[model samples]
Target: MDKSFKIYVVVFLLLILGYLYLESTKKQPINWFPSYAENHKIPYGTYVLRNELKTFLPNVTIDEIKIPPYIYLEDSTRTGTYFFADEAINFGDAEFFRLMEFVKRGNDVFISTHGIQIDTLNFKTKRLVTGNLDEKVFFKFYNKAFKSKEFTFNRAFINQVFTKIDTLNTTVLGITGYVNANNERTNEGVNFVKFNYGKGNFYFHTFPEVFTNYNILNTEYEQHTANILSYVDSTKPFLWDSYYKTGKSGISSPMHYLLSSKYLKWAYYMALIGVLFFVIFEGKRKQRSIPIRTPLKNQTLAFTRTIANMYYEQQDHKNLAEFKISYLLEFIRTKLHIPTTTIDETFYKYVALRSGNTFEDVEKLFKFCDEIHLKNQISMDELIKLNKMIEKFKNTIQYGRK
Candidate 1:
């Protein structure tokens, strides 16, 4: 019945539909470490070690330790040999002291490359053999290359010169030879020396590549390792330490470092603070609650008349026809509280009984209301008939309830 109200309904529906479409297209972010692990071939050994260390050595447990070749030797705890193919020649005073302490405790140590320099002058002293050398050459040494199958004087001289001065019982078990500079062939000494220390013994060999997994299968090295293992008490567990320095700095993956449990609580608190800041700074922006009024040239009735004029000006007969039918349906549903699913015959009978209207009158009103909606367009006369039917239907429901 009202042109202005019909326009309001169309605008409201458009706004709601637009809001829903925008919300559906919004994107959400996701964390993806589980997917990353599955794609890469990294072993889960670090996780396994962390769990086992916690279980066995509760007091001595380390939460996390970076495996090396990435830091300096002085900073590392070299409890065992650093088994790598490359040389670590930059042994500072601290590193040297640690290595000495490790060996003095009777623990065996292995070094693959031979050119480790402790001090510049001491290294030169070891390199050169000068005049005024003492008659008694006390260090034990064994160069197998120089010796014949039987015992020989040349091999014994070198062995005696290299042996530990404090431990007279120390001996060189085996050796291998190499070529010297100037195309001269000489016994460049390679030997295994064993020294007694406290309750245990220290075994040092110049050639260390023999113990690597790549060369350990060789019969000679296999026998060497087996012999060493035999001397070690099986009751004490052996440590397979592989820590070394690769001369680099900073973290590998900073995201992994940040996401670790060590920083998880701090990250959570930081996120909460960010959200709180957002709410205070952006969400609390001053909003206008008082409605602003613009001076209208026309009053409420005049504005309503203008909307009515537009409807008539457009000559939108189909829209007007549909509007009349929808308005009547909604009005009847609201006024009588009758569900849309109710049949017209049932509705007519109830209305006629309650309103004391003749059954024929109610039937005619229902018929005209249905005819206006089913037609594509309605004439001015037909519109008046539909309006009259809606008016009568509303009045009957109101009076009957009283």
Candidate 2:
């Protein structure tokens, strides 16, 4: 590599580091997912709220419970405030009845969501849009503590408007609205409401995102949530729900424990990656290439040709004939599995039966073989005749077997 190129690479890496540092220092975007679980640290997660509650209410014990409201309160132990946060609360009739009965036992319930209805507390939500393309709005608490002071939020979202209120029992906690296209400041509707159920109170707030990390980090917005939480009974233990929004209260299994921890999880992943790379590189290095195999050269035809050439060059007709006769007898003994040491009528009959050849062919082939073996110097014509008879006998036996 060139010296200038190396310098360029170093400068590029430094720029990346600078950019990452700047980004980490900057505020993150608003996460709108409803995850009330304490493990999540995103903008919408209640992790900061849960921790802050611990500091603010040191005397009270905050428990994240996942069981149903009825089952959780069945022990009749100290009754405390139940806090439920989500996008919406669509409780079934049985659950709704159970929660109502639980609240009847002098236990308070605080629910924060976009909109919900419980018994007499009917909440009708609407969205208010103004001159701006993004529907951004401002809201203020209706209580006397804030003195009707308003604070503007940073992001644009659907401004939830509470249209109906059971005025006899419900009190408006906070109000929100947006300026219309006509440049008129319009109070769209209420955003927070509280109702008296039976012996206890039910606090329902529409703007759940106010308690999120993104808004709670802001001094102005943080005070709003603190003020809202002040309404809860701090004298009793707090039951922070981690079940409704997400169906999980704690770690699911051993896999979750392994992956949730920072160092242990990273170590596990690095070990797996190391094993994969080891298998790849070590397999490549240790594996030996297979040697190429050539077929065994058949020397049967070559040996036959050599023998035939030698016999013809020496003009040894009698020797060639005797060799052929011996080869035929050996072929019958080995291939047909018969005794061929004797040459007689009994031998012919046994060979005909075992070799699957006719008796006449067997007899003729044996006679020719015996005559050739007895000859001292056979003529070329007699050797040729014996060869033809041997070949004919082999063909007859092969045909019969087939």
How accurate locally, in lDDT, is each candidate? 0.44, 0.74
Model 1 segments beyond 4 Å from truth? Answer: 1-86, 102-112, 118-170, 178-188, 196-201, 217-221, 224-235, 245-402
RMSD of each: 36.9, 31.9
What is the C-alpha lDDT profile of model 2 across 66-161, one tens digit per residue?
755644654655478899887677664545676777777888888887656654456566765676554447777877887777767877655676
lDDT of 1: 0.44
Weakest 10 consecutive residues, lDDT, candidate 1? 32-41
- TM-score each candidate: 0.28, 0.53
- Write candidate 1's Cα lDDT for 207-298 as tens digits: 33333332233443344433433433333333333343232223467665565433463555457756875776577686447788987675
Q: After superposition, how far is residue 243 of candidate 2 from its true place, in Å?
A: 1.6
- Candidate 2's C-alpha runs over 4 A off are 1-32, 76-78, 115-120, 129-131, 180-184, 247-402
Error of 1 at 75 (Å): 15
